[model samples]
Target chain A: MPPFSRFTALTEQLPASVPFVGPEVQERQAGTPFMARLGANESGFGPAPSVIAAITEASATVWRYGDSESFDLCSALARRLDLPCEQIIVGEGIDSLLGLTVRLVVETGTPVVTSLGAYPTFNYHVTGYGGRLVTVPYRDDREDLEALRDAVLREDAPLVYLANPDNPMGSWHSADAVTAFARSLPDTTLLVLDEAYGEFAPDGVLPPVSDLAQLPNVLRYRTFSKAHGLAGLRVGYVFGTAETVARFHRVRNHFGVNRLGQVAARAALEDAHWLDHVRAQVAAALQRLAQIAEQNDLQPLPSATNFLAIDCGSAVRARSILEGLNAHRVFIRMPGVAPLDRCIRVSAGPASELDAFEKALPTVLAGLT
Target chain B: MPPFSRFTALTEQLPASVPFVGPEVQERQAGTPFMARLGANESGFGPAPSVIAAITEASATVWRYGDSESFDLCSALARRLDLPCEQIIVGEGIDSLLGLTVRLVVETGTPVVTSLGAYPTFNYHVTGYGGRLVTVPYRDDREDLEALRDAVLREDAPLVYLANPDNPMGSWHSADAVTAFARSLPDTTLLVLDEAYGEFAPDGVLPPVSDLAQLPNVLRYRTFSKAHGLAGLRVGYVFGTAETVARFHRVRNHFGVNRLGQVAARAALEDAHWLDHVRAQVAAALQRLAQIAEQNDLQPLPSATNFLAIDCGSAVRARSILEGLNAHRVFIRMPGVAPLDRCIRVSAGPASELDAFEKALPTVLAGLT
Candidate 1:
């Protein structure tokens, strides 16, 4: 049957494609579950016992809608981030927040700037809002700040996205460099500073909140999905100047965040010990993964995040290695663009999962030639 | 201190008002929790025990992102509804789905039709997307379907909304009447038939799946928030022709639904015995509420859903009664517009909450003059 014919012209022109086909879809297609799930950069170490306890406790109270204001969670986040509650706006997840952010600034044909192969979800939202995307390529496997600034000025883009301790490549810039880049942007441009992996980065890798707190043009986003291991719960927040963040109140899904997510996130925030434990475990796993890469005669790119990007020499070789590992029922991902696609990205997980990857790599690589 | 100056013109013109200020906000302002929660129409009977078990069981697996496609939940809903999986789209909630539907059909100055004050959340989304709403006043306290269709034709509107077993009034029209209304609208005017209270409504009040299944312009929205008592989990869905539902895939946040919500919803759908039990309890509670209204010399409207609307003679009297009940820590709501505001709305809950409401009504009525 013909579809509803009244959708907006913009909707008609948009492609019905998603940013990523989830691993579960792959498992269903292959008719088998992967032995090792190392894609998506999820913390398979799992949420803290305290967080799990909180979720279980909150399960019975699931009849009441979550706080539309998310008052308590925001109050708790404010104390931790040293920002006033008015400067924070919580939503379903960073992806949802990114969509709202784009909707606030973009109209048809409005220019948006970002790294070419950076977070596809961000790009998806930009296009979904009918914004014109202006992309800059990465330099030395890192988001090139100078090129991004140049593109923003050239295109007069209203928005730009940057993820620190970057995705797919697992690289990062020092706090000084990031702050300098933010200061260099025009006031008319809003920078979406994504720090989803900030918890796993080294101490000096993330800029102090106060460093950019004075700028209305900068909004920093963080999530419980990464370090806290609550990806499935869907809670993320963005903080900026109080005046700037209040704009989100104009368009956000007020009751979007789930009740158990609020409970789990608040408990996760209070558990410093578990966070430290996950950090140490991730560090050790990254080290082990580097060794495995070296043993296979591959170069492991340095990462300040919980994943390693091992260069497989060429894009074709990387593709073959990825397919071979998939044949062995091990799930992992590679970047989408040229130079970056030469490496395979693996998230830090439990030892057993890593052991599965370790066992599968040799046979896969041996068959690659 | 200024908000970022680069937000779009539409964003600037939009007000920062929310649809409903949650009861939690009121409790915070009152400096105490309510003795009873009869507002927001939440199920105080809570989710089924089996559903809670499912949530607790799934809590540990939250480290993994929920399946972006919502394959299992959609598959289960398809089986229960006897529709193809491709015809359904699961989302964060009906509120979120409403927003997406408006986005797909609306642009600046686009005309949309609905009853005045029918559902503020739907109005909020229409205005957020810059749609011009053409409203028809309710006739005799029920949605004036003939007037709504007239407005759609008059405005050449692309969208219209109707909530069955309506909120704030607890009144309904027969399935045949609703089907006739849907058939009268032009194919270009998509109908958002909200069935949030469908589970609580009397059986013959809802249209059978096959009644309007062939109309690409009609979509039905249902939720677990009411009869299934999973409001805090944020799971709602829309079903239409397979071709029409595919448009949501172009713009929806792929991973928006939470993992525990999907698990709880699946379990709730399967627990037919529990649903029947909840429906029986709600029937009893509604009877008790009607009696309580009569004891206070008020008129209780006939209801097919799980709430009672009692007329207090005038808007001023209704406002006074609502304030008095609030002072007694018994939370309830009133309609927003003129003739409808003459009544107060109370949701059916557990017996203890009903007892609190029953006790408070006499004192509130005595002070109303």
Candidate 2:
């Protein structure tokens, strides 16, 4: 049958495309689970034991809808960040929040600025809302802040996105640089400063929470998926000025965040020692990943996040290596655009999974050669 | 600081109103937990033991993202419903799906039709997308199907929402009647046939899945939240023609459904015996609720779903009874619009919770008198 005839013109014009093809899809196609699942930047380290307990405990109460307000989680987040509860709004994940943010600011033909080949989910939301994308190419495997600012100004873009400790290439800027770039933006331009990888970055890599909390146009997004190791639970939040964050309530799915996510995230927050252990594991895994890339004659890019991007020297080589790894039952991803596409990204995970990737990489590279 | 300057004019114009204040929020304000939690229509019997076990088992893997495709869950649903897997799309919840549906069809000033006291979340989503709502009031305590059809025809609305075994009043239309109403609408008017409470509804209250699965403009929304007792898990799905269902891919949060939710929902769907058990419990609880209302000299409406709406003779009496119930630590709700406001709605729950309500009702009623 023909598709529904009444979908909006924008929806009709849009192509059906997912931002990411999950590793499970590949597993189904291959008819076997990957021996090492590392794709999509999910932490193989998993969540804290306390978080697991919380989720298991919460299992009995799954009949109750999650507090639509996400009250406790937001309050705990506020306390940790030294911000008022009004400054924080918890959501299903950074992806869901990004969708809401785009919906709030984007209208048909509205211009939105972002780095080319950045987080595709942000771009998906922008295009989903019929916003015209203004792309700024990365410079030296890092998002070019100056160029992004230029594009935002040139297009008179009302919305802009920047991910610190960036995805795919795993590149980052100093906190001061991010602060300067954020401060440089016109008040009219709202900045979605995604800090999904902030927990893994060096101390100096993230500005103090208070530094940008007062900025009405800056909403800093963070997730438990990375260092906190709860990707499957889908908990994330954005914090900004009370006035700006409150606007999320005007459009957000109030009960979108699952009950266990709130429970798991709150437990994850309380377990600081577990977070520290995960960070240590991620740091060690990054080194092992770098060594593996070097052993395979690939250049591993410097990373601030819990993943390493190995420069396979060319887009063709990167694609071949990625497919070769997949064929060897090691799941990994790569950047989708030029320049950055020369690299394949591997998320930090447990030693056994990393060992599988380590054991398979040389053979996969040799097969490609 | 002022709110972000880039929020669209529509977003700025919208108020920060949630469809319902969760019991948790009310508990916070009241400084104590409700003795009976029945306000939100969530199942109090809880999910099946197998589902709980699945959640606990899946708790260890909360670091991995849920399969973006929701492959296994969709396949299971398709198998059970005798539909192609491509015809179903699993999402965070019915609420989130409603938001996406509105976004897909409602552009600025687009007309959408629904009953006056229907699901507020749908209205919130429609208004969030700048859709002009054309509401037809309920007739005789049930959604006036004829009036709804007339409104759709009169407004030339692209979208119409009707929840079978509907919320608030817990009234239902026969499957044949619903099928006829759906067939009568213009193919251009997409019908969001919400069957959130379908499992609790009597047999033949829902058309066979195959009957409307072939219709491009008729999307059937079902959830694990109601009878399956997994509201906290936030899993729901929509099924229609493959072509129309595929459109969800263009805008859905690919990994929005949490991993444990996927696990729990799949488990819940498999446990038919558990569903039957819950239905029996709900049936008994509904009768008990009706007895309590009648004992208090209030009239209880006939219901096919898992709730009873007690008519307190007038809107003022209903409001007073609802407030008295709140003061007595018995959580229940009433419809928001006039006429419907004369009814106080109570969900079917465990005997302990209902016993608490049963004990408190007379006292609350006497206090009100």
Candidate 3:
């Protein structure tokens, strides 16, 4: 029999496809696990021992639902960030939170502005909500902030997304530039400022909380999945003006954040020393990765994020290298669009994984030559 | 200054209210923890030792994102249910799945049918999507199946919701009657068959998998939160025809299900002996609760779920008893609407928790009288 006949027109038009293919799916098809798991920008240095301990301790109480308000975790984050708890909203992750943000603003034919090849999941959400995407292409391996601003005005878009220390290309804008860009948007246009890589960026790169905390039209998103190494737990938060953040309560899944995630995230926040340790490890790994790239005659881009995007000179070479890496059981990803597609993105991990990547890259490039 | 000026009209119309106030919030308000948690229908018997072991074992790998496909858990569920993996969709919980279903089918002013005091979270999702709700009042403490069918036909609703072995009033319909009710709906009207409590119900009370598996309009949702006792992990699933289930992929948060939740749920499913133990405990707890109600001169309603809904003879009396119990540090809940509001609901827990409830009941009842 055919499927139910009365799905919304928007739902009917949506393609049955996921944003990114998970490494596990690739493993299943390849009949083996990847030797070096550096894809998808996950932190392989692992969460703090305290966070893991918290999760283990909390497992016995798995029968009780999490606090619907996420009060304890929110309070902990508020204390750490020096923001009022009312200004923060915790969610399953930045991905689910992005979907919620899209749902709240986008209706059929609503124009949403975003950079081309920035984050496919954000584009997926906009299209799922029937929002017409207005794309601004990257200029010089960076999210072209000026072009994005121009498109928002041209399309009169209510929503615009910008990820600083951006994905696929590990480029970043100065804190002053980002602040000026956010200030430029009209009051009617809400800027979804994704700072997923904020923790890894240098001091001058990220805007202070006080700089954008009071902006009603800006929502800053951050995640524990990156530097804190809790991607598997799926915990993230968005903070904005209290009045604006209140809207999430209207439509959020009240008990969506799991109990263990809440516990793990709170513990992660308290462990400042562990975060510093991961940062040092990531920095060293990135240096090693750059040396490997230089040794293989590839250009490594300057990075503010945990991952480095190496220039393979051409899209064809990049594609060939990605495929060859897969064949060697080295899982890595690359940009989806052109120009930027000339680079392959690799995340920082332990020395052993980097050794695997180093051993595989020379052979892959040789094969390509 | 003010909030962002351009949230969608549906979002503006939505009130910033959650479906249920969690017991944790109340404990904070009261500045003390409840002595016994018998509300929210959470299984206090805890997850199986095997499930906890799985969560603990998997906690060390918290850096990796869960498989977006949820292949392992889905495969396990398929083997157990004798349904193809293509027919299953795993989500954070039934709440998240319900929201996705509403988003798929309901648009602005789209007619949707459900019982008056059924799952408020489902209604929240419908309203969040701007669906017009057509409520059928419960008949004889159960969902009025015929009345629901009439309303669906009359309003041409694209969606209808029913929770068999229902919530708020722990009553259920026979499997044959439920099958007839599902078959009665028009092909255009999709039925959200919530079976969160299915594991606790007697064998014949739930429709056999084959009876409704092929019906494109009927989707069955079950959870690990109830009988399997993993509410805090936030795992649930929906199964139907392959084509219908495939629609979830279009909008689902690809990595929303956490890694440990997947592992824990799979372990819970494999431990059949633990589930049987929980069932036997629930049966005994329900009997004990009924006896306590009878001793307090209240009428205990027949229940097919893990909770008992005792009729307090009037809504005012029920409300008074609930307040009095709160004063005694017992956490329980009641229905939100009339007739059903004449009862107070209590979940089955361990003997120590039941002892706390037993000690508090008579005094609260005497004060109410």
Candidate 4:
């Protein structure tokens, strides 16, 4: 039978593809679970014990829908961030928030600027809304701020996405540089400053929340998925000026945030000691990953995030090494675009998972040779 | 300062209002919790113990993202419904699915049809996407199927929404009538047949899953929220022809479903005994609600779902009774539009909650007199 003939022209034009191929899909195809799940940048340390307790307690009340306004969680976040609740909007995840943000600004043929190998989910949302993507290439594995600004100006783009303590490459810029870049962007161009890895970065890497909170054109996105260890809970939030963040309510799925996710994230925020402990563990794991890479004759790039990008000299070698690691039951990822594709990205995990990666690396490298 | 200047024209036109005000928001305003929680149609009996156990067990793995494809849950749903997995797409909730469905079909100024007082979320989504809603009024407290067909034909709408065993009024249409209505619509007009209350409905109320599964334009949306008692988990699925269902992947948040929600939903779906137990309880509660309404000199509408609509003779009396019930800490709701607004809607919950409503009713009615 013919499909529904009336889907929007934009939806009809969209390709039947997803932003990321999930690890579970890969596992199903391979017929075995990866021994070391070092891809996707999920926290291996897991949520704090208090968070687990909160989730367990919340399980009994699963019949009650989550507070559509996300009152308590937003209140807690407001207190922690020194912002008003009106300026914060909690959503299912960064991906959901990105989709909503895209819907707000994008229309057919609207220009959106981003680094060529930036977050695929952001790009997916842009294209899903029929926004014309204008790509900027990475300079030395870091998103080229000047070129991204130039594209925004050249194309009169209304949206731009930048991830700090960048993914896939694990590189970062100084706080001054990021602030300067934000100041340089046209006020009409909304800057989606994604700080998904902010918790793991050094003190100077992230500007104070207050620094950009006044910018109406900026929305900073963060999540518990990375350092706080609740990727499965799917809670994320964006903070901006009250006028800008309040607009999300007009378009968002009001009850989309899960109840246990709110409970777990609130508890996770209160457990500062757990975060510190995980930070230490992540630092140690990053060291172990670097050592593993060096021992196997690969270059480990300096990182401000909880992952290392090991340069394998060329994109072809990186691809082969990634496949070889996968065959040995180690799951790792790489940048999708060239230049940065010369590296394999491995998330920092517990010592045991790192041990699997460490053990498999030499064998995979030797096989590739 | 001003808001971001470049939000799409449709977004600027949308009012910053939500479809439903949650009970939590009400509690915050009243500075006290409601003794009886029945407003949102959530199951007060809660999810099965086995589902809670599954949730607690899955809490430990909250660091890993949920299976993006929702593979196992979709597989189980497909097996239960006798449909192919390719025909199913799981999302955060029915609300999210409805939003995505609207995005797929409704462009700016596109015409959509629905009963005037049906699911407001569906209407919200249509308007959020700039669709012009063409509403048919309820006939004798049920969605006027014949009129709805006429409106669809009149508007040549590309989308229409119908809730069987409907919300707010607790009314339903026979399966044969519903099937005939589906057949009457233009094949180009996609029907969103929401069966959120399907479980509480009688055997003949729902058409066989296979009957509509073969239709390319008929999408059936179901959820774990109503009878399965997992509202806080925010899990819902839609099934249709494989070609039609595949369109959601291009626009959906692939990782939006939380991990424990999937685990909890899978367990809830498997707990048939718990569902049967809840059904019996709901039937008894409905009878009790009818007795309470009759005692208060109000008319109880016959219901096939988990809630009843108690007619108070006029919209003013219904409004007064609803406010009175709220003042007495009995959380019940009334339909938003006229004709339907002559009744106050109350969900069937545990007897204790119903007792609070029964105790409050006489005083509320006396105050109205």
Candidate 5:
């Protein structure tokens, strides 16, 4: 069982861990399936009918490997984003893209800046690359843009990560503020703008794709996992200047993106009507979740993403609810680190699942009382 | 459009080129679809009905990211391979796994060894991670095992790559020779045994999975992309000592493997009947292709793979016939270097597609004349 003694020093020093425990893993551990599967911020509404049809059609052609270049999908994305095709690089997900971006700049002991408990996946990549993490605490439950900018300059870091309409907290900075924050970063630093949930963000929360396209240091990523509801497909893309995205081609698995993902993503993009409908449904679900929180004397933070961070008043209380829900077969996740962990994160689910959450919360909390 | 000036020197120097050009790209350039889609070594026979059923049923679950741990798929694979679940780590593909392996061991200017014109993706990853490639030419259409071992020792390489049932030329070394190669390497040097087409190789051509499992220095890769007819799903897994597989955890995109791929691979593993059928078909097609090569006054090399490389007397003649096939809407590929490029490589397809090849080869050759 001895490991090859020759792995890079950084890899040997790292511990085996994952950024998030998948709901499936929870089900296996709990030995019971969740009554409500809203933990991972995946759209329970599912992909459009058209997307399903496309997938079924592609199932026959699954023998041929997907285009390593991701040509058609990138072309489609470029047209949609109003950027040239050269500016885009498709990947397995924003998670993979983050790892690639980190590898491009981070080396042993390299300083990388991000909010303390933002996207654990980004931090995982930084640590994987042997980069020292410099974290700025969240301010007012939002990624503190001013502090992040300061940290980048103070550390003279080469990499900075921010997620707009952020995960876990589901709070966001305005597009104008993000633009200013990106502009403020040193030219030596690469800014990774993770907008995995941009399709569900409120108006003015996402800047125009062109807004950051020309910045050599900025890489903005988006995914079909959110409103498009094809998360199981694992297709997301990053776009910036041709030179910026071109670097991805050098290190990327040209065939990394799967064929099912490519077909589903293309179909999802063409299903504009379905996107609008899903967005409306997500908005409604957010409202319903907020109402459920209000009824329970819990504070639901403002959300511009598919999930809401419900304030349970303290981290201990939030932990209790999370454990209780899992015991009750209601799978949910919270932010890993405090103070973000004080708020239990719940994703928008269909009415049936939300109803299960509504029915279970009071009883679980009452038993605690 | 300039890229950032601060990229790692390795990233800056790596070329924008990729390993494989997708058949779709070739079709686009050909301005016509192929009559016989026999390139890239895909199974035109397609997957089993049960596998497609699995994919369709899994569509409703596409909203969730695949299990980051990929436990179920790994367990299924372990059972299939008679290994423990801990021994297998599924990845986006063999291509992606190779990249991770390189990242684990390779630093700038780290020496790496492979056959000249071996799998380009492996070379890409080595160059990507700043590993210097030392290539040994094939001997009598087979990877020169002695030269590879000598290079590994002389260059003090930490990593080496070998593909059984090699691509660009469908050649294979005996399983005994392969085991000897793995045993001959230094314990500090890791051997990436790429067995992508192992299923097509004769029984004695691939070493047993357990043969090299005890060698912490050895990792074997297998994929559903070829004989199993799931290439587009992008599922490839590597099995090594638990120690080496553990290193993948330090950097793998846990959710990088898509949901459908996980399900399809699990389903394919369950369908032993389909695998047997495809193997027989591939063998017969190789026979048919050989006969056609003789009809064209070319020598077809003995193949342990789904494709055959016919010696067309010269590299120029091979290129002319390959180009003529494309002009005839009969898609095929050839090796890139001399000796190998003197042969045209063709994959097996369904009867009708093979019939297209049977009909078109003579006319295309006549047109060349």
Candidate 6:
């Protein structure tokens, strides 16, 4: 049968691909569930008991749709961050928010800037909105802020994605460096500062939330997916200047967020002690990951976030190591392109899951050669 | 402190708005929850017990992101529909899917077609994507198939939305008419057949799934929101020719659909008895609603779906009745556009709530007069 022919040329030209083929897909293709799932940067500690209790309690009230304004959650977030509620807008996840921001700024051929090997989902949104992507390669495994700023200025790009305590590599710059980069960007450029992993990052890595509050050009993105451990719940929030944040209402799927997500996220926010505990756990896990890399004669890159990127020397070797880990029922992944692809990225999970990875790594490396 | 200034002109021109302000927002503004939530077409009877059970069961694994592929749910949905898994794609809800479809088909100045008072969410998506909506007014309170076809042919609209057992009016075309409408459209005109309320529609109102299976131009939309009572779960699916469905992956938020939504929807699918019971309840509720309308000296339009649209003589009277009902703590909604706005829409819920409506209708109308 012939396909529907009405899609614009840009959509037709795009490949049928996802930013990441999930680890669950990997398990399915392997025809067995992985014994250790450390590919996705998920907290294996699970949500705090309070969050689960909240979810279970909210289950009876699931007949009602979530608050379209997400007022309570926004108020909580704003209070914690010292911003007014008007500056905060909640959505399904930062990924959905990224897509909305891209849509707002992009028309056909509009230039969008990001790192060469940064988050593919951000790149996907840029292309999905028919924007021209201008990417600068990572300088020393960190998103080269100077190059990105230059590209934005040179191309007059209206959108830029910056992940602090970044994904894949899990590397970061200091708060001052990030603030400087933001201040340097043109007012026309809308910086999507994704802090999905911010809760897991070292304290000093994330600039103070109030630092960017008045800048309409900066949208700081965060999620319950990482440290809060509710990725499956699909809740995230974006906030900045009220003027810019208000624009999200124009295009957001108002009732798109599930009821449980709202319940789980609100509860997660209320449990800051759990956040601290999870942060400590993730820090310990990262240390364990670094030790494992060293024992296996691999170099583990420094990460402010939950995941560790261990350089396996070459992309070919990294691929084999990833496959070997999988063969041993340890699921992990790596970046897609170039120098970054030379390292395998593993998320911090439970101790037993990390033990499985530690045990499997040496054997996987032995089999690799 | 200056704001970002580079949004597309169309986006800048659009108002910051939600298609429908959720009842939760209404409750916040009113400082009290509605006693009856019959406004949003949500199933107050609630999701199957088994579905909530699935949610509580899946709570542990929610720390991880959902399957970007949404494999298991899509496979189950495909099997139920007898389509290849490749031909089925799921999203946060039909709202999100509509946004992606609009992105695929619409550019600035792109002509899209739909009924004058159709699903506001679809129109929101079209406007968000800068599509010029060419609306064909409803005929006899049902979506006008002949006029929509004429509009599509005249403007060569690339995308058209048609919801069966449609919202607000709760009216439908017979399967023969629906099929004829589909068959009448040019292959180039993509049909977004929203069957969000299909589960409650008369059997003959829904075409055999196979009838449109080979028509690449047809994409049938279904949701767990209506009869299944999983609206709060944000699970909706669309199925079409494999080739047409493939395009969603090119632009969709792969992990946008929540894990609980997947689990709940699957469980909802499996609970055939609950669905059957709900449909039966809906049929009875429709009758009760009609009786209430007749008792109130209003005309309840013939309905194929779970809601009743009671014509109150004129638009102003309908608005007054709606406001009066809400003032009495009974939440109900009406279509926003003319001819359609001449009626008030009431969703099917447990009769105890409808009893509140039954009792309040007279008092509300007495004051309206």
- After TM-score superposition, the amount by which residue A33's alpha carbon in candidate 5 deviates from its true location, in angstroms, is 1.5
Residue B321 lDDT (model 2): 82
lDDT of 1 at A246: 94
| Best candidate, lDDT | 3
| Model 6 Cα lDDT, one tens digit per residue, A1-369 | 668987898898988877888888888788899999898888888999999988888886676777887778888888898899988899999888888888888888998998988999998888877789898999999999999999998998888889998888999999999999999998888899999888877678999987878888999999999999999988899989988888888888898778889888989999989999998899899999999999988999999888999999999999999999999999898999998999999999899999999999889888876
**Can you write out model 1's per-residue Cα lDDT over B1-369, one digit (the tens) per residue?**
898999999999999989988889999999999999998888999999999999999999999999987889999999988999999999999999999999999999999999876999999999999999899998888999999999999999999999998877888889999999999999999999999999988878899998988899999999999999999999999999999999999989999999999999999999999999999999999999999999889999988887888999999999999999999999999999988999999999999999999999898777755
TM-score of each: 0.99, 0.99, 0.99, 0.99, 0.97, 0.98
Q: What does each candidate score in C-alpha RMSD?
A: 0.8, 1.0, 0.8, 0.8, 1.6, 1.3
Query: How many residue pairs in model 6 have overlapping backbones?
Result: 0
lDDT by residue (A169-202, candidate 2, tens digit) is 8899999999999999999999999999999999
Rate residue A344 of model 5 by lDDT.
93
Query: In terms of DockQ, which candidate is stronger, 4 or 6?
Result: 4
Compared with the true structure, all predictions reach lDDT values of 0.93, 0.91, 0.94, 0.93, 0.88, 0.89
CA deviation > 4 Å runs, candidate 4: none
Sorted on DockQ, highest at the top, how do the candidates line up? 1, 4, 2, 3, 5, 6
Model 6 CA deviation exceeding 4 Å by range: none
Candidate achieving higher lDDT, 1 or 3: 3
Q: What is the lDDT of residue B45 in candidate 2?
A: 91
Per-prediction TM-score, chain B alone: 0.99, 0.99, 0.99, 0.99, 0.97, 0.98
* Clashing residue pairs, backbone N/CA/C < 3 A, model 2: none
Model 3 per-residue lDDT tens digits across residues A233-283 = 999999999999999999899999999999999999999999999999999
Model 5 chain B: worst 10 consecutive residues (lDDT sum)? B1-10
Q: Please give the fraction of native interface contacts (Cα pairs under 8 Å between A and B) kept by each candidate.
A: 0.90, 0.93, 0.90, 0.90, 0.87, 0.85
Tens digits of per-residue lDDT for model 6, B223-307: 8888888888888889989999888989999888888888888888899999988888888998999999998899999987888
**Per-residue lDDT of model 3, residues B297-318, tens digit only:** 8999999999999999999999
What does the lDDT read for residue A75 in candidate 1?
A: 96
